[model samples]
Target: MNAIEVENLRKEFKSYSSRSGLVGAFRDLFTRNYKIIRAVNDISFTVKQGEMVGYIGENGAGKSTTIKMLTGILTPTSGKVIVNGMNPHKEREAFVRTIGVVFGQRSQLWWDIAVQESFRLLKKVYRVSDKDYNEHMNHVIETLDIGPLLDKPVRKLSLGQRMRCELAAALIHNPPLLFLDEPTIGLDVLVKLKIRQFLKEINEKYNTTILLTTHDISDIEALCERVIMLDEGKIIYDGSLQKLKETWGEGKQIQFTFVSEMSLDTLKELTDGLQVTWKQGEQANVWTAHAPSALLPEVISRVVNRYSIQDLNINEISTEEIIRNIYEEGVVHG
Candidate 1:
């Protein structure tokens, strides 16, 4: 089953302006000057049931706009959105009950209320029965390790603590679809790991369909097998994560620190005719090279034979760098 189906989706906002003067102000009452800003252009995609897909883009790429339309917070100017077999905007009251949303910087909990109180309010709002509520609530508290925070006021919790509680609250009703926007933003390493693990387990155990949007590349790398990248309100790439890496990120970067400095020219002589590009690092003793992964053995062997290496490190081209390049170079696909 398809969890979400969007076709020719487009959203536009009007920007109106007028001259600053008494005459202009009077004229503005009768006449309007405005331009249409297309936040989300004609884009289409489908998310399968139980699939965890990453929706990623740079700022101003319309990620938030699309999400707003999906959750029924904003109406689309054109096209269609069907989530869980219903229109989000048309079937809002019933639609909201089937989905859960979590924003990293925005808290759904009441600030002055105790965490447990807030959860109780949500339980009543969602009409979750006592039997299922207790079963799920206990499971979430144990999984997130937020049992001790139940009595504390929302204002008293740290960012990590609040986020854990947020996840638990979102799951109180056991919604089938989950939307997470930067759920790991501003979180510590240990907290991020725990949240990622929790998400994975939930998806596996209950077949929850998740649509995750985040600027943190590590989160996407860890959680998503497929990614939909939007640029200028259009879908630039939508495919497997591994295929993306293999296609655009074919080389490995090797950083070497030698006991003695080696000029780029001399290093070129050592690895003569090999397709290695060497660049100097900020530190004089360190140098970095980019070469095909298949040629790494030859490149490293040649360098090791000539220099007394202090340290050597091999790293794949990061997803962050790859996405930046795509943005700058305007790489587009159909």
Candidate 2:
């Protein structure tokens, strides 16, 4: 069975149309004039068991709204969201037992309590067995290096430390599915690397299904094989990371090192009318442009023959460039 099945899911929020004043607030209580904002439009997608999927979009793209609905924090305005074959909203108490959720900017751990105290409370709440809880706690604490931090109050820990603790709290029960929203936000490079490694180990060792939502593209690139992109509350793209690139990205950035430095105008003149973009460096002249793979040879030849080329190489397009190209040009919608 699919880990998640969202069929034509949607969520709408109501906003009042009133002036900014106490009188407006009092009038709104009597009249109740409000406008509907479709935070999530008709969106449908399925996530297979153990699949690592990236749910990404720019601000105001309904990414959070969709996740909230699936987690049962907010009921959908229409359609269905079934997680692990059960309606998340209707079966919330039972469904939460099978999943873990983390939001980078928020903390699930109690502020005034020591970190391990929170863990103990979680054990009781989840009704974890002594054997499983101890073993899992050891693995989580050791893997994340939170042993030293277990005694510290959550309010005393740094953002990065708190985040690590939060992750451990989520995994303490060994839930089959993990929902992470911006898990790496505000973390330093080293901290982010640690989180990524931890996630990889869990997926490989236990086959934990992860649904990650993040504005950080690197998180998506590192953790997700499949991505579902949303635009204005609509599903724009859904497929493997490579497929998204192949369909929208013009692969390969060819770099040329000439015998001598060439100005942009000179380079453009050499490869005229071919949509070639060029740049010059201290040691070598550089050119970055988009060219289809099929016509790459002819495109290369046109430049190589015209200029006194020293050396050249081609590189794969970056994930950032690919996504940017999509948003700039591809008007994908539900």
Candidate 3:
């Protein structure tokens, strides 16, 4: 059975048009001047058990709206949202026990309490027995390396420390499904790496079904194999991450260094057949093109044989580049 299922799920909000002045502002309160904004339109997808899927989109593209609806924070304006065979909003209390959620920008922990206190509260909220809670809590603490921050109040802890606590808090219940939204938003590199590694281990060990929503492409690349891309509240693409690359990411960003000097004319000649778009530099050229990494060896061979090639480096097309092109050009072209 699917772990989560959404059928033509949609969410609409009102963009209220306010008046300019005090009198107008007061009058506008009663005036129904607004436009219907479809934050999520015809969004539908299913996640299999133990699958780590990336739910990605730019800001205001309804990624958060879709997650809100899924987690029962907001009732959908229309359509169905079912998680683990139950309605998330209608069966909130029970439904929550089956899932764990961490919103990086928002804290579920109480500000006045110590980080450990927040975990205790979650344990109580979930009615976790002492033995089960202790087992899971200890495991999470070790996995996330949050033992040091346990006594610090939620407000006093650094952003990274608190985020670690937040992650531990979410997993205290040992929920089978997890939702992480920008979990590495402001973390430093080391922290992000640790978090990524911990998450990968948890997923592999427990078969935790995770839906990660992140603008950080590295998170998607490291954690997810499938992606459900959103555009203006619509499902723009949904498939294997590899296929997304093959379909619209058949481009390489190449950097070339010359033993001597080389001009754009020389670059043009060397990469004549390659669909190249030069970015910058002359003696050292950085260019982007609709050529995959597979084409790099030949390009390198050709340039080396003709020009005084000193050094050459090829970067595979990034997830950001592919998604950016999809958003900007409004189409995914090969």
Q: Pick the candidate with the highest TM-score.
A: 1
Q: How do the residues 230-303 of candidate 1 rate in per-residue lDDT, one tens digit apiece?
A: 99899999998888888777899899999987798898898889888787898888998879989999999998
* lDDT (tens digit, per residue) of candidate 2 on 77-153: 89988898789888878998999999888889999999999999999888999999988789889999999999999
Each prediction's Cα lDDT score?
0.93, 0.86, 0.85
Following a full C-alpha superposition, what root-mean-square deviation does model 3 have from the true structure? Answer: 3.6
Task: Estimate the TM-score of every prediction.
Answer: 0.86, 0.84, 0.85
Model 2: which residue pairs collide? none
Candidate 3's C-alpha runs over 4 A off are: 19-30, 256-274, 278-312, 332-334
Model 1, residue 104: C-alpha shift (Å): 1.3
lDDT of 2 at 68: 89
Model 1 lDDT, full chain set? 0.93
lDDT of 1 at 27: 92
- After superposition, the stretches of candidate 2 with alpha carbons farther than 4 Å from their true spots are 19-33, 254-288, 293-315
Model 1 earns a TM-score of 0.86
- The 10-residue segment of model 3 with minimum total lDDT is 281-290
Local error of candidate 1 at residue 224 (angstroms): 1.1
